[model samples]
Target: MLLYTAMPLELVLDGIDRKYNFKEIDVDGIKLIIEPIDINHGKIVRLISTNPQDYLNSELSPGKIIEFKM
Candidate 1:
């Protein structure tokens, strides 16, 4: 199963991580490293990958809705 969110990633992920403590996610057969970046007011979510070119070519790129396996 896959779950997608249009809401702010930080809000949704922070809450979910607090409850479940998940560190990574699998989407489209790729394992993404999830990290949080603190800015001035709040934190933003960052998804890291070893093959960044592949990641950029995937549906998980910027301006696309993020999808994750549940």
Candidate 2:
């Protein structure tokens, strides 16, 4: 069986060169963590907004999978 069911993901930039710990997501009840990785084309970005702008802005890994979001 699959350990996790993939869903939509939302991430905010936390900071550069920082380590993030895995935790449960309030949106979908899935655990997730994001660590810094190579920059994508020399640019760092993340999912900064939700449908209703409920999530706050923070630095995050460019392609790190934080967790599943419904």
Candidate 3:
């Protein structure tokens, strides 16, 4: 996607200064997308696991806070 404009790059791009803190982690062989809430905890963003069983676990659903180690 290309957008040609006379505006400055900073002005043309929106929210470029915002920080994105998304992280991926593999917990017990299941993959997940997490947004950190603290040093040791993060809120679940989504399951990136290929196994269907990982999605079936209600505890792994989005918005659930889970503790993780770096």
| Reference-based TM-score of each model | 0.30, 0.16, 0.67
Better of 1 and 3 by TM-score: 3
* lDDT (Cα, tens digit) per residue for candidate 3, span 1-70: 9989999888878898889899998888888899999898999998888788888898899999998766
- lDDT tens readout by residue for model 2, 1-70: 3435365333332365566542222223322233323332222233333443333323233453343223
Error of 2 at 3 (Å): 31
Q: Relative to the true structure, how large is the alpha-carbon lDDT of every model?
A: 0.48, 0.34, 0.88
Q: What would the per-residue lDDT of candidate 1 be over residues 1-70, giving only the tens digit for each residue?
A: 5659788767766755454322465555666544323221112134456775755574555334343323
For candidate 3, the TM-score is 0.67
Q: Which 10-residue window in model 2 sums to the lowest lDDT?
A: 23-32
Could you tell me how far off, in angstroms, the CA of residue 17 lies in candidate 3 after the best superposition? 6.5
Highest-lDDT candidate: 3
Error of 2 at 37 (Å): 6.3
Stretches of candidate 3 off by over 4 Å are 1-17
Question: What are the clash counts of all predictions, listed in order?
Answer: 0, 7, 0
Q: What ranking emerges by TM-score with the best candidate at the front?
A: 3, 1, 2
